[model samples]
Target: MAQEYGYRWGHSGLTADFDLDGDTPRLVRLARPGDHDLKGAVEAALPLVDVVLLGDGTGWSGPRFTGTALGPRLRHRAHHATYGDGWHHLTVELQDPASRLAVFVEYSSPDGVPVLRSRVRLRNDGAAPVTVRSVSSLLLGALPSPDVLDVHRARNDWLAECRWYAEDVRESVPDLGREFHGHDGRAGLRLAGRGSWPTDGHLAMGAFTDRTDGRCWAWQIESASSWLWEAGEADHHTYLSLGGPTADDHQWRHVLGPGEEFASEFAALALGDGFDGALAALTSYRRLIRRPHPDHEHLPVVFNDYMNTLMGDPTTRKLLPLIDAAAKAGAEYFCVDAGWYDDEGGEEDGSGAGGWWDSVGGWLPSARRFPGGLRAVLDRVRERGMVPGLWLEPEVVGVRSPVAAELPDAAFLRHEGGTRVTEQGRHQLDLTHPAARAHLDATVDRLVGELGVGYLKLDYNITTSAPGHLAHSRAWLAWLSSVLDRHPGLVLENCASGGLRMDGASLAVTQLQSTSDQQDPLRYPPIAAAAPTAVPPEQGAVWAYPQPDFTDAEIAFTLGSALLGRVHLSGHLDRMTLSQLGLVQEAVAVYKSLRGDLRTSVPFWPLGLPGWTDEWVALGLRAPVAGATYLTVWRRGGGVAELLLPVPHLAGLGDVRVEVLHPSTAAPGAGRAEWRGEGVRVRLGEAPAVLLVRITAGG
Candidate 1:
């Protein structure tokens, strides 16, 4: 072990350090990497005192109890243990003897993977209950601040989502003057998620890059509800703090009775050489934390009749031909999207105008829509060698739905005044109630076990208020866990409007995530390119909507976008000519060949993170297999036709070969591509064109 400033670094790169000495242990470095070599500065810059003011006019922080005979101070020592697969568990225990309040700071790190997972647990041993107003999941004393640092964050909207931006940290928070005592003043930036949809306003992720050293640290809060992270400079060191559910943000307050304990959600931290390296580490860490599912390996292509295709109105007549076309295009799952459960109008007269949203909860097959019954359409899907699936918004009931009247008020989310909270013409269900759980359980059982449905596209369209949001999230997790446990083969697709609930907590339970609901093919490349930043490549379902009206180049561009991620096939394939359909078939074949690689691949950007309207954007997936990489390049209107893409990972490999593996119509040499020094030179003749290049070494 290497020791400095009372901090010790173990062989596994974990560093154990405290915020202040001679005080109850307030762990600031839990599993922090030892190679950083900034221990002295970090220790010296530790805050003299940390406190949270309570309603009783007492300051509570760092696991100590107030108004106690132990003089309001607690002391702790570090302990460690080893588990399976070189996993290390480090614990720091602090206790207020007089008040009998104990707090444990836990850190878990596995060998080889550069991730430090931290969570806090509080236990009350006193006879009286103790209330915790705030507790941080992680508190880091210092982060590298090499001359220039860039702070990165993701902005999300309804259709235009996962747009990332990087800004100079100093520009956002002007430097505190460097005086004789160095920078004593503090400046900070706080990013947070507010409600049920943890990713509604922004992603629960952040990164800081030290330009001088090319070093970066990235972190994400694995939470389904509210979360907050703050980066600040105090004294001469920078501190990063992360946590979930606070009284101020989520109206979260926990009372720990005698011998009772509460644990906070885990916060993951990673370190790397640059933004790419950090992202790679985070991606690997994400894989480690996700619940293993066979779908991750199978990576089936799904055809959902939404997006620019059916737009939610699907009848037997409208779906039969689409089903045939989808299977012909190599899709393995055919999902009849929304409007499958509507009962307000008959299929012949239904226009899906005002009744779709308000008539939700019945979940019964529409008699008029599926004249031969919904099972008939599903049977056709199975006969075409595809799995049958249906879209469901399970957590809500339309106010006008008959099921809403049948279920008790306790089954739905209600305000303090006993009135149910409704949004977007739907009433949210509170899964914590048994009746609600039973209803959803029966729905899944019927759809999967009885109907032979192999997949479910679960969607949530509205947000709930405060405590209800957190409660609903927990309930949803429980219900999903039960469903998945009962039917291990059933695949679940999570969506909220579109990409709103795309957080780690929900993603862990679902097999795939819809990247967005953006309809325009021209505006989808950026979203598809940036999705890996928020979700794993195999789980990000990008839509490939090819219609007869689109130019051949446009078809390739749209189809090529989904080649790099999970293909959410859509569009008017049933109405397309055989030639147009051939292009879709070619793209699907290419994706099938590459889908296996996607399971073990991590994303990299040759052009860096994409802008909403960038002329030329490129995304590369570097496979774990030696000398193998898949590159997707797009040249939009008005952009340069020729560009050089640097592939640092393939730099030392000998004699690289690149080939266009999609769109059989593109001539053998439609686009000029050659392996140059440390990169590939790609030249396209026209705008709005794309190339899915398979690159390998040993040519």
Candidate 2:
């Protein structure tokens, strides 16, 4: 194949003429059969969305798009047409389903000019390298993506045809009969028209925008035998980009030599995160979620039992001493977990789980151990100058519980024998259902009203299982909000086994979650290290993995991460030895001392992505009005990292002093003072990280 069709408005590929004769689009001299007028057709098709501001497909009038009969401006490609060392196959095909769909595809440059040289390459007969490029498109009749601008190039647009070799086509559909039909929006490549195969989604039309290279341009990609063209820029738009994995479509195949064929073939890409607007839009959304509510009284840090391994504490009085220690250490709330129930068997009590049921289950404290009950514990907590907190596994219901007995058919996803199964634990209540809410409502009342607990740690062990579903998060919010309204002064600390359901929506109901259940001092830092990568530093990576399993030094370092978010504390002080208790006191002291600095800084993930070595360096900067530049790095791994602090759009702090606060063994994660203008450089030797507390002075 040498050269095919090159029809242009002014150049080769396509020809565009004004609607001289009654606006019907004139053709001076036609070469093909059909006379056409497909100029400015993009504007007519998707009138709502425009090309980028640079070029918006404005200078229309180009190729006359038609089917069956060849139009005056038909475009195709040919490669090595005159050479002998070539195997070429020319096939004219119709790519439309029924009479209702139309196709409008084209090729564009950064300037919004269509790619004119329509060249389809045919190379070496037996697996030889071929310089291939595909420049083509098909526009839908009237599907409009309103917010998009035409400045986008081939990549981030709607659709594209992946470039392929002779061995790429599974089985060519040679000459296909064409039957024109009515009009359908997805006009790109008609699935049933050529291959008679079903498509993933109705693809209307695709176009182009940005024309820069690499970060902003489109290029065809091939690894071994597959061909995929990267099109569509995902800035300010939110479309699912095919990035890491293969797509669901199995339509593509590589035509290998002889009996070899291509299967597992599909094009994948990365799409934008979708857009609402500017950063202001994000701020507004945040404001709505973190709105000040009198109903949500500040609940203090909860001292948990699981990580502390203090569950079923036979010597219950041991917990009292720990409670006193924590109270002295400045904890505003103390909660007793599972073992303090009325049922002997409920939690090592051997009293049997008689009270726990589907209807009002997990409502009672283990009665046998806490023969004194949850109320007595609350009274003790209050005497220590802290609001009493209680832990409740709200989303789960045990089959042997009384609450489960009362819940109706819709309350939980049930089976024959009242056995409810779900993600976190047994009997997951479908919060989206009304009956589920009612069950949760009654349970919350018993805990909030009867138990007199001012704080609640809602436990959800199951990660959500609904796929492609949007209602779960909001339904969860409704449950939390209802609880808030009932208690009116309770702080709902969220926990799902560990940080499972932590996302944008979860933030709306509760402030923090027990980041990880293990809280092994050795384990906490690794997870905390990855927090910065997933979320901004301003938000809480406040994971509470400080099990009795950690050394004192580890505990202190883990608490330092509180600057990133709320630090959850779990463990009983009663069981800790004197030295361990002293360590907790010291760590708590430092956290309180640095609260102001930690609250104001913006955390950044600088030295590349957080790797699996349980190590990540986090940097946060606080530049409010006139203040010291404070930064913290939680390095889980000990390595000499080139500490490159990222200061993308951060302003102010022109000249400031910096210093590292800890560590004598390794270089300071924060030590010494340096006035290095806005950008301060430092070396954080093998130590986890260097904490930089900057102070500015000038009149």
Candidate 3:
């Protein structure tokens, strides 16, 4: 065995050092190769694994570890390392003498990728059982103090999502003169989430960068529900702890019997030069971990007749014309959104409010809406050179739905004892139940086998927070993977009331993510520009709905929102004039030509990340191998006519060419772009206008 003093593990582009000289091994250094080594500068007193049990409460009364006694008593036992499939896996086992709990801090990282995935495993070696209250998937101490670090977190909500804001860490966790008190403060910044909608209130990611230097670190917790992350001062040094469900916050308790083992959720961390660099690394890591799909490569443009068009009320008459228009507009997939399965003929006014909300679980086409059978509409979609799709919310059964009564009570999620969990008159399906999984499998198989649904917009509109959310979440992903495994050709789009459940876990299994439900043409720019921060560009499905009454500028503004990401083309194209429709067609064409590079490209913000109400916003996709860069700039109601977007990569390269790729004929007050010193200067004379530009080196 290696000496129990200092140990180092080095792999592709990553270096980790542990201080085994102490009673408990401490992860003193973790960084990119040749980066700063965090040792001696700060004490290696923090434990590599932090755990909180039912009776062994924290040593300190805070979200961090100062109060955790078990953490300090966890002595180094043994470690094993292995490599397989271009990934390095390391598990360090530690034993708490008093509790006789064997904790394994497991870590895995892809070769040459500056990203690490962490999780914890626990095996009870004691005579009696122990209840685990909370455990950290990854915890790091001795981070740069708040004086030199600025924390970055995104504010998320219904339509407003991925809005990032940066603040000085000192402001959030001020210096409390702990030297005088000899103890860490009891307060810190905590970003947490519960319920079924993981990203309902906030995203499961955060970052911190040095104020002077560009060094930065970012991390994301991969959990569908009930997760907590906190950054606080421990022994005067900053510490970050990330974990899944906890008893204190989510009423999650796991009883580990003798010899029983349990594993926590996975969390990933990456390091880069700055926010953009870190996010780019994270973007690459997201691509690495996601399920492989042809849709990611082809990036087929989907036209959903819901937002700003049919509004979920679909019928044979209403969809036939739209299908033809969508085909003409270059959409490769046509998805008939919600209300397609409304067998209960209530009121059909284009707005899906009548029987659509509470009477949902049959997954059958409406005979009344489709008098000639839904196949005729689907056939029309296929004839238009587009694949057919349907909307489904498989995790819920409406109170009045026949399937709700047909399935046994055990099929639905419930409280710890027995009561079923209901949200908004809908019972949540627990995929952990074999019966629930079978029901969903049957529904999906029927849709794909019988109706020839090549695509499915799997939406979850209800939120439930019953006990056993962690297990149910894992089973849900397993069920989704199993469905995809069986129906290999079927593409799934993950949507939860628009970006509510946008997490790495869901995106890893589903092919596409609906970025938002924002209907207004003017309000989508910010969301579109920052979507790639949480989702890969090719996987982020952004809606572009252009109405007939919209001006040329309005049409370009909305369509430009999706050019850099997956084109979720919506709107009443059938009603649009030829001139108005031409713009949509041109934008779709531009997306197709650019999408091939998006899968391999990395996103960058020439002008720092956009603000919620920023007058101007820009999103860039740089394909290094292709030697091309695409920029989509939106000028939304501002007096500033010119934007100097810095493209550092193109800086100092002589004779660069900038071309407006969209809006074939510019509007009356059109936008213009040209090569400047180190960036492109885009001038848009009109408000609410957008331009898609291609930049390349030229003679």
lDDT of 3: 0.86
Model 3, 647: alpha-carbon shift in Å? 1.0
lDDT of 3 by residue, 649-679 (tens): 8889887899898766445777889999799
**67-145: candidate 2 lDDT, tens digit per residue:** 1121212222211121122211112211112111111222121111111111111122334222111212211121112
Candidate ranking under TM-score, highest first, comes to 3, 1, 2
Output the worst ten-in-a-row residue range by lDDT, candidate 2.
192-201
The TM-scores of all predictions, comma-separated, are 0.93, 0.55, 0.97
Residue 41 CA displacement from its true place in model 3, Å: 4.2
- Given candidate 1, what's the lDDT at residue 133? 62
Which portions of model 1 show Cα errors greater than 4 Å? 5-22, 26-34, 44-74, 97-99, 178-186, 625-627, 665-669
Candidate 1 local lDDT, 186-243, one digit each (tens):
4467787877778887889989888777777888898888888877664455667788
Query: How high is the lDDT of residue 174 in model 2?
Result: 17
CA error at residue 633 for candidate 1, angstroms: 1.0
**Cα lDDT for residue 163, candidate 2:** 9
lDDT of each candidate versus the true structure: 0.78, 0.38, 0.86
Scored against the true structure, residue 558 in model 2 reaches a CA lDDT of 57
